[model samples]
Each structure stands twice: as C-alpha cells, then as structure tokens.
Target: MQRVMAMRLRLLQRPVRIVAQSNAAFSTKAPEFSDIVYGQDTGVRTVQFNRPEKLNALTLPMAMHLTQRLHKIEANKTVNAVVFSGNGGKAFCAGGDIRALADNGKDPATRHGEDYVADVPKSQALKGQGLGTYLALTGERLKGHEVIGLGLATHYLPTSEYETLVHYLTGLEFADHVPQEQRDEMIHEALEELETDEAFQEIDPEYLETVESVFGALNDNDTMEGIFERLEKLNTEWSQETLATLKKMSPLSLKVTLEQMRQGAVKTCAECFQMEYRMATRMMENPDFFEGVRSVVVDKDRNPKWSKRDITKVTAKEVEAFFKPLDKDQELILYPSATAVTEKEE
Candidate 1:
C-alpha cells in the first residue's frame, strides 16, 4: 500500500504542457446509431452509449463514431458541455470490444503490431544515443509525462473509470509477488472496511441494485467478507449512480472528459474536462487497452498477452514514450475556449 502511494506521488511530479495539433482524423467516420440521445440543454450536449446487450462494450465503429460525433459537437455553437451515457443500463462501457481487437490481431496487417512491439526494446536502447529511431519511424510517443501531467490535475470524476482499470491491471501484475498469507490478511481487512464505507448509502437503492446486477449477488454472510476487506484496504471509492451516469452519457462527452484529464494538471474541474479529450486520442491506438479487454472480456482465458508481456517488461523509457506529443502530421482541433488555461501573464 505504501509502495502504491509512493509510486503515484512519484508519477505526479512532472510538468504539464498543452500542445495544439490537428483534428483532421476526427471526422473520418460517421455515426450509425439513431438510438443515441442528443441533448443541448444547460449548455451541455450529450451523446449516450445505449448498447447494453454486450455490456456497452465499444467496437471500432463505435470508437470512430464517438470521435466523429465529438468533433461535430465541439464545432457546434449551441453546445457548451456534453454528457455520455449507456442504454439498457448494464455498463457505461466494459471498455473496448476485445472480440474485435482479437479478430483484428489475427489479420495479416496486424503482423506489424507484433513487430512494432518488438521494436520497443530497440527504442529503449536508442535512448542513450540521443535520437529515438523507433518513435521517429513508428510515430510512437511517451505517456509517463502525460500521466504525470494528467494525474496532478485530473480530478477523480473524469479519469476515474479508466484509471481504475489501469490500477486494477497494474495491481494484478504484482499480485503474484504478494504471499498468500498477506493477500488473505489484506482481504480480511478490506472486507471489514466495506461495512463502514458510506458512499453507497447516498445512492439510490435501485441504482445499488444495478451494481449487484452486473457484479453478481451480494452477500449478507462472511463468504465475500474477505474480498470486501481486501478492497477496503485498497481504498476504492466508487459510486453506482456515478457509474450509471457515466454509462448513460454520450461517447463525445466521455472522450472529451478523458482527453482533458490526460493532458493537463487537475487544478480545477474545467481543466480536467479539457484534458480528457486529448487522452482519449492517445489511447485510441494503445495496445494495453486492447490487450486488457482481450484478457478480461474476449478470450476469457484470464491472461492478457500485454504488448510489454509483463509490467516489468514496461520500462521507464517505454512508459515515458507514451507521453510524447503526436507527430506534426497528427492534427488536434484547438477549441481555444475549450481549454482551461490559467497560465500566469509574464
């Protein structure tokens, strides 16, 4: 626990920079759902996710549709804010569609995916040479600084879901290191903490019901007590209503929220929103995300063949690479008014 907090603090100590790029690719796709709800009230426009059968899982088309819709809404004068939600009430999104990614992984073109991941080691070696050949040639970037930049400024609300998943996966990578006895002890502690956690108390009982619907039956007995105890020690504070609202919100809103959170420091609420959009674009091509879905959702094999293979396989250089700004060719739409700029005047 001390280690996790220490790691988080170390990660947060970095500078934030907002570089404008092109938004040219945002309109490459079109929306396919008429079931999507649109609202321009309260200066906020919302686009809901609406697909619950597959747990609101996102497909490539769905991702493309979301990107394109966000572009349109950002350009519209009537909208000042946007909300994303899901229909059928199962999930906001379990994450990307793993089945699609697994299918894509099988394609001949995806051979590059493996080769490119292989080249990452070479890229790390290139660090000492002062010229990174891998990034220059592959158009790859670093995320450490970006995460550091984002974590310092991104409030829990917008980036919470994605970061929660990242934390879960990150912790999972270290699970083997923990002795069974310690694991059981931590689990017991977390379970006891759950009883006193009152965030659930304020949420609607019906919404609380939905959580059980997705996670499965809750227990009145001691069966799940250890699991609950372990979770409490981890100090995870999540609300079902907030999760429901996120699930029901529009893809456009979600993207924007994610990008803003990823891009800048979370000094203010407005700043976080601006960062969410940028972060989404970065993850659009990230391998961990796709791999995460494959392990947890698609294959059901419970093993994610991460691009890095192991978390330790992810070096400081590679994590640093994720924060690098996109190449000059990648366009970012600059909504000047959309930015949360509070830079002091010289």
Candidate 2:
C-alpha cells in the first residue's frame, strides 16, 4: 500500500506535460466524421477512440482531434462527466503510432499547425470541480481493478455494469456551475450502487511494499546504473525481468527520462512542458531517434542499434544539453510570456 500510493503521489506531484499546443488550433467543431468520434448521453460527452482496428493507436490527426474535443468539453459549463472509452472494448489505447513518427524525419520544428486549450482559470484552481480523476498508469501499465489500489480510479465498476452506470451518471440533472461538494456527492451516490467491491487481483498491499523496495525513483540517489545494481542485489524475478526490459531501451533515453523526472518534480505543468518541448524538438533531430523508430517501428525489428548502447557511452553533458531552453520564438506558448524553463547545470 505504501509503495503504490507513494508512486502515484510522486506522479501526481510531477504531472507530465509533453503535449504542445498546435499553432493552427483545432476548431472546437470537428468534421462530421474522423478517427476520433464524439457522442452525447444526457449531459455526458462520450469521447470514443474510433481506431479499434489499430487497437486504438493514436495518429497525429487523431490526437489533435481528441485534444480539441477535450478543450471544448472543459469550457462547456453544461457538460458533466466525460467518459473516455475505445470503440472496440479490447483496449482503451495501445499507445501512439510511432511509424508515422519516422515519417516525421525532421518535421518537429515546424510541427506547429494545430491548436490546444487551457485548463480552469487560476482563481478557480482552489474551488474547481472534484470529479477530475487523474488516473495513474505507470511503468508496465496497471489495468482493470489494479488502478483502485493505487487510488488512480475513484470507483471499480465492471464492464457488465458500465452501460447502466453511464446512463445513471449522465441522467444527473445538475445545472451549470454546481458546487464542488454537491456534484461529488451526486457522483458518489450514483457509483455506490454499481461499483463492484472487487479486491485488487495484482496490486495487493504487498505490491506497494514491492514497489517501495525497488531501487527506482522512490530512492532519490538511484541513477540508471544504481538501479540496475540494486535490482541485481535484490535477485528477484521481478528485478531480473525489469533489468531485461531496461536493457533493451536506448541508454540515452533512459538517462534523459531519469533526469527529466528529477527536474519536473519541482516544475509546474506548463514549465515541465516547456522543458519537454525543447528536449523533443532536439531529440527528433538526433540520429538515435531515427535509428530507434526504424528498428522498432518501420523495420519491425527488435534490434535497435543505438549510438550509445550503454550508459558508459552517454555523457552527462549530452543529457544536460536536452534541458536547455529553445529560442524564444520556438518556445511552447502556454502563456503570453515566452520565457522558457532552464535546467540548473551541475
């Protein structure tokens, strides 16, 4: 319990803000048909991923469409809970389609055609709606009832009862700008009748203890090398499997991920994104990015010939270079100010 909660808390504290606002900005009103589809059920808007054939893998256009719908929903005062589901129940989203990313070759710098929306105003930050559940899907990805143990999902309703639950929730007839407490109580009552009292199958109390025991982010000093060393010391099946998985990933990416986690821990959502944008634009231009996408996606081969195959091959300065701010004109425009967040060099 301690470890899972700790992991979730850490993730919540440092929300990942990688998605940048497209320059063209999506019109809230989407085309009549597209990869992303929308439906209305009472006050609830169901945003269903229509690419079931691709296991709901997101293309760039699909991502842009979904982003626009979300912005429109967030701004709509009449809207209630937004239900996100896959058109085919197999998977919500298998993840992004990186094959297209390889085609991107060098398009990131001018990847500024779409628009993005903002969140609740700063004044409403303290008294905002209570139903905005931030689901924590980390590491290998927790699924189904496992999310409840980590406080990721508010309720655990089975698929059998999903239709009825959605109907009941949407039937809720609250007016615009309802009080936070009242709105929460209404949802609590609706879910109480349907939420299955199913015990978590995978993430038991011991699971959290296991996560805490792992030499990862929970331990402040755990670098990529240190983590591998600690896992070796543990000598458990989990550690061995994790080691294998980490070994397959590009060394430079692993280092950058770890460092960014440390930096993002103290930065605001917007700040974190500004940092990621700089890193992303730079990464797209790197040879490693092309090699990775080619081997993993285009060629369908598991063998990725990374320039820096091992940690010894990647230097601190190389990782540090990714955190530097982009030019003011190229920076992510979250606010009117164009100042970028710079990493403090060691």
Model 2, TM vs. native: 0.73
Q: Considering summed lDDT, which 10 consecutive residues are worst modelled in model 1?
A: 111-120
Candidate 1 RMSD computed on C-alpha atoms after optimal superposition onto the true structure: 22.5
**What does candidate 1's lDDT look like per residue over 121-201, in tens digits?**
222222212112212222244333332232322222223243332222222211234554654443233223222223222
Per-candidate RMSD vs. true structure? 22.5, 12.5
TM-scores, one per candidate: 0.32, 0.73
> 315, model 2: CA deviation in Å?
0.8
- Top candidate on TM-score is 2
Lowest summed lDDT over 10 consecutive residues: which window, candidate 2? 128-137
Tens digits of per-residue lDDT for model 2 on 13-120? Answer: 331211222323211235355677776644567777888877887776776556556666666656668877887889887776655655654566444323212222
